[model samples]
Target: MKVSKLAVKILENESVVYYDPIYHGRTLKVIGIDDDPVEVMEYLLAQYKEKGYSIVVFDTSGHFPTGLFESVLRIEEGNPAGLDPLKMARMGIIKDPYSAVTIVQTIYELDSASTDKLYADFVTGKVNSIADAVKAKKNYSEIILEGYTDLDEMLFSGDPVRIPESGLIDLSGLNSVTLTGMAFLILAAAMEERRRVVYGLYDIAVLTFTGAGNAGLPLLTRPARRRVAILGTKYPLDQVLSIPGPTLLLYNDPDVQSAIYESQGVPAGLRAFIDKGEGAYIWRSPETINVEFGKVLKLQP
Candidate 1:
């Protein structure tokens, strides 16, 4: 049950389910029931990586195995290697200077006028990073950048954060919801900007927010330009079903099955076909097929 076999199961049989990125990218929601969604995500991550897709994982729990990736960005407290929005803007990875401001605003809740001025200074090269802002004696700099000393240090530490082609962004170190959301915005903005310049057929971003719960929902509102897979545990049922593209139902909750039947017009008898750990339901565009997930071998440290 390797990922290659799983891809064949999903792609080879077009009558049942078809997933060709060339036709359109997919948003796969992997729901866990008897099995852990993280394990399922790991399996899928291997599958996509093997297929040559550029990967960017937003692991909210930090539980995701960093060994599986070639690079890791740990945004934990005391870590000077954290992401820097200002540096990303300077590198053209953030696309817009205002987006860099938005990242800061998400973290500090800075006033619009202050952020606007910051953005202006950023574009004009008058201010480069948070450290620069503090040094230049900006009016709101102290208030906004007071607690984010590590971030400021990383901003000009001369070690720029490069968005890896295949890597895991560990957000577990960010304890506050605002900080976590800010990380998401920064990475999302980077991915969007990257896709604009170098769009590829198999470029995929796996955003695993299993630990963030309902707070993770807001992060999914942006329309995806490339393939995006969401692995979660507690997303609202309606919102889960409403997500267009393919959906893998590893959970067999009655409410979920009933909702799938009602919304996707799946036959009631098909409910029995979905086993707890092994068998699962895959809802592609016009068809819902019962398929066994590929077995995932844990990566060694």
Candidate 2:
């Protein structure tokens, strides 16, 4: 069944509950969205953590209170994978805003009934390959992100997160406004390849010299789950590693501005090189109004 977006305000006393027929009188808890919103997020995170319900926080407002997650993932500086609607539109691949991407393989007519059903799903999936077909068929990537056109431009591959053995990396040059994007990009991208990754959060900062109280984490973490990607930036924010999966922190060097935007300190060329995980140079954070055309997040740094 196609599920419309469900929003419940899970507060102390005012929330909704869902029941399961298979569980024979068991009910699923729902929360209210009335107050701080942090509590609702925490409750949801706790509920979904062990149950394997992946959560995606659409951070348009730029606040991620992901204290419940075990880890925070981060991506170094880079352009998106080059699979973007605007770029595709510029190339005359599409005529309208509602995007329709063709498969990398030659798509032919499938006359069989089974193939027709599969074709419908694959077309609707917004995936790139057979592995994704199988994964989408399995509902493996539970959290599918479909908002924020600004963030999707950096990817040539057109997927939200790419999973390599090293770790998770955000491929989009959009969403560069906050440091959390880099941290969570790594975490979310890493989780696609594996079950979970670890992150260091408030506790780590209190004990060690990492970060301080609730420094708005990236948007990749869900409640209760532990992951393995550790996050640290040259900026004077606190650091933490609460997730249980493989983790990596940012290089504690000078604050590079290009790392935070698509333009500014970045060189016009070598955009993909930065996306490939070589984020050591090309920054313009020192200047005000650093935004510009041509991928702001450089490839060199």
Q: RMSD for each model, in Å, please?
A: 6.4, 21.3
Tens digit per residue, CA lDDT, model 2, 57-107: 322222345454443333333543533322333344433222212211111
Residues 203-226, candidate 1, lDDT per residue (tens digit)? 112222322222233344334454
Using lDDT as the measure, which candidate wins?
1
**TM-score for each prediction?**
0.66, 0.25
Q: Provide the lowest-lDDT 10-residue window in model 2.
A: 23-32
Residue 279, candidate 2: how far off, in angstroms?
45
RMSD of 2: 21.3
Model 2 misplaced regions, further than 4 Å = 1-35, 70-78, 81-153, 157-160, 163-301
